[model samples]
Target chain A: MNRDFAIECERLSRIYRSGSIPGRGRETPALTDLTMQVPKAVVFGLLGPNGAGKTTTIRILSTLLAPTSGSARVLGYDVVKQAKQVRERIGFILGGDRGLYGRLTGKQNVRYFGALNRLNPKTAKRRGDELLERVGLAAAADTLVEEYSRGMKQRLHIARGLLTDPEVIFMDEPTIGLDPMGAQELRQYIPELVGQGKTILLTTHYMLEADMLCDEIALIDHGRLVALGTPDEIKRNFSRLTIFEIVVNQTSETLTAELSNIDGVQHVETSAEGIFQKITIAVEAGVDARDQIQATIGAERVESLVVRDPTLEEAYVSILT
Target chain B: MAAALHNIALQAYYSYKGLFLWLNWTAYISNVFIAPVVFVVIVTLTGRFAGQSDSANAYIIGMAAYAIPAILSGGILQSFCYERTFGTLSLIYASRSNRWVTYWSKGLLHYPNGLLAAATSLLFGWLLLDLDFSRLNWPALVVLLLVISFSCLCLCLFVGNFSIALREWIIPVGITNGLLLITSGVVVPVDQLPGFLGEIGRVVPLTHGLSALREAFEGASLGDLVDDIVYELVVGLCYLLAGGFLFSLLEANAKRTGTYESAI
Candidate 1:
């Protein structure tokens, strides 16, 4: 119940019962007893593998779904009991093109959603125009949504979600189908939305997108919170090892054994790429075991060697695996 | 308050104009404009083929009255059905707009559309059926058309409650249409219909309303037919209220089940 937190959930959980059979069916749990909070005026990213409950959490907080157990509050209003208040203060840009009215013109679609949020006609018109322009859809405002491409439809979804000028915006894969330029522009717009004193909770599969946009990222797996921290903190804390990627003509157990036996070598993984066998070695933070490993492999078998810091994507994979 | 009214107007207009596939010019022309005329033709031609050309006027009157269910019911049903298909119903449910206002206003445009189609059928009846226009009480018949059209709209609103919850409109709409055909005295007399159908005919829209319509066409006064018109109106309102109640109940259930993201 912290007032500073824009979004708060206490052991929020949801189970979907499949009523496929007459009296009995399997139950699927989309979210566990997950408690999390996002502060105001920042981009909070939820990163997870598929079916990790990111969308379910968004749906609950946005007042689109109710928790089977526990509770969630957005902007200090209960998502279930005070849904009207919550819906009035929040907006959501859910992924996929199916949510929009395909037969309506872009402007009409905006106007329709504005009306649903009870936006006054004149204000809706002005704000709809502003949002459509901001989303790069002003020119196509008069065009039927069915005629628009997948990217254009997505942009319209953004415009519709912003029509109410919500305090907390939940975006589920906002840039999923956008072109590179559109995606880049949308990413740039995220912080600008935050700058307007709005809290944004977004879910995306792009590690770089989360790294670049999220002030704090929460990674969930199998309906549970797995990791939560700033991008740099996660990358640094989760993995304090420099990685060495070595290419060889081929690798044998002897080479792997020798590399693993080297002092300060933390972990070694092998995979084949193209015609060459690649050996990825994780080394301890303060240990320079590179010369010993390369010497053990010998110069004749060593095709190439590259050293680099761990990326957010690499850290994410390490923690998840 | 004004904004809420605006929401209703916008939702009603956009639902009929954008959400329904009948907005497409070709579909509109073929389905809305052409279909009613075809229905009238089939009934009149059937009467002629049965060597009962004298019964053509009654058949045309019965058939013309049918535009209420055919036009208004379908129109109102689509307001609920297409919203689910487009995944916008869930969006509306998640919003702060008044659900009662949104639900009832869905048939605003459709009621008038049904009346227009009914009038057109009447005009076609006068032109094609060699019917007597002199016997028709224009004022009383106008009231009858309006009442029956609204009643049918309400009936569809009732059916729409399930059209959305079940995520299948075709079956419900088709069954409703078939029931009206057999039980609403569109082509058969209500009393002449078999036992259960006769009872059903009394409860549905056109049976009572159409009886009054035929009387009004024969120059019966509106005051005398008030009982029948009232019965029709009461039946319609009952359906509408039931629909509204069921809609609220389903919404709560959907929230609990978490199926509002799409129709279940």
Candidate 2:
């Protein structure tokens, strides 16, 4: 148990013995031999597709479930052996669907959960009010959660998760069901929380959110971790394969051979779309094929010639596949 | 420990905040007034036809005796079903309140409401039937209600915790309601329930508890009600202990398995 690490899991795995769902039979392993470490105050993103074991990992770390076999520690407390301690250290927000109760007011819901966390009435009330204000729900704090818009409800849920003032927060799809503006609101708020020195572990399949918010990311697919690194680090690793898109003014069959003949040009494909020709060229290692390719294609007919570093989306696809 | 209990109680109070108070009071009022009235009317009609020497007041006492455990069993099981169905039970688990505090507070708070209803109805019934209980066995009646109520609360938690599937909530509520309706000895005395059924009925705390209640209203001494009261207390305690233990075990297992959400 490293004092500086907020979460540590060694060979942690989960096997869900799901009852057959129509077309499938037999138990399936939701997670397999998973291992990860999250340092204190770091915003780590668990990036994965649907059913990619993100929720399973969060649940295990939150002490909501025991692993089938392996160990997990949250804030220096063993998840299985010191579940109550682990629970106390970690605040968990489980998606938008499990938002605050529709009938209770925002303050009321927060106070209710605070009381359950063993806060006295005065302390609970004070904490609840502070959290409501922090989440920007203080103006509508008295209104029933049912009256709150989707974003307000989401903020209230986040407020409820903070009632205990946990050192580590686990958000399993914080902005999944939110509208664009709602997602943007959380996008701004989350980084602020991270700035407050709270370690956050978030899961989302949205590359944009991961890229914008995560300091470090682990990409999981088909229950296996495929990529783990900072966004810039990952982009740098995949930069060696440069993709160039060329739009030509005229269609020419001979252009393929001409582009391929350029130094370091490994692959070229051209497709004609009405009056314009779309060409893709891949440059080989240690190659500066741009000027050579431009000259070969005759720059006057080339409407666009752009070469750039890979986006997280392109990098993710390339790494996962 | 007290703070822990207080926190648990407050959480439970809020969990059932709006509708529970109304529903519980309704269940209480109906149990107190309507149950005994229905029992008295039926008994009086039969007595007139059969020309039996049995007093309507004695029947009222029997019905009131029946109301005590009826309220207990019905109160606990029905609320458990409602919590399970409405997804509130899972919320409680997720919140991390002490399970024992939940069981205790739920039983404690709801039992009073049930007892209030039972007493009000029984008092009304006794007045309507011209009953006098200046020498009633107070200890026996108190013992019966307390023992039975605790047992019912335990049983409800036990069943509710174990049956995690949404559909599983039905079986326990149905079984409990059916058991109380037939074997409660509130409507028909245990002796008239057929030999095998009567023996099973006797083993049920409902039969013995109701009998003790009748004896109490008839001015039976504590000594006279001792055997039956002992039987109710002993069996009810056993059920309470066993049921509570089982419920905690299931709750821990469910948390470990991450099935709390699916179960609720």
Q: What fraction of the reference interface contacts is present in each model, in order? A: 0.73, 0.30
The CA root-mean-square deviation of candidate 1, after full C-alpha superposition on the true structure, stands at 3.5
Cα lDDT tens digits, model 2, B1-264, are 666656776666655452142354576566655765676557655764676546565566655555555555544554454555544454456556666666545555556655665576567765665566677767766766665555545555455444443435446656764665577576567778878777767655556666777777767777887787778767666666676676576657665666655411
Interface DockQ of candidate 1: 0.62
Docking class of 1: medium
Model 1 misplaced regions, further than 4 Å? A20-23, A239-242, A245-280, A283-294, A297-309, B51-54
lDDT against the true structure, each candidate: 0.85, 0.69
| Winning model by lDDT | 1
Stretch of 10 with least lDDT, candidate 1 chain B: B255-264
TM-score of chain A of each: 0.85, 0.82
Q: What stretches of model 2 exceed 4 Å from their correct place?
A: A18-25, A238-298, A301-304, B1-5, B18-96, B123-147, B162-168, B191-204, B222-231
| Model 2: per-residue Cα lDDT over A1-321, one tens digit each | 899888888888787765548657556687777788888888899987788888888877876677888899988899889987877777877565443555667877887777767777777888888888877889999997768887787787778887887889988787867778768888898878877889999987788888899999887776677677888877657434577888889756787988888877766878776788888886753688878888888878889887765567766765665
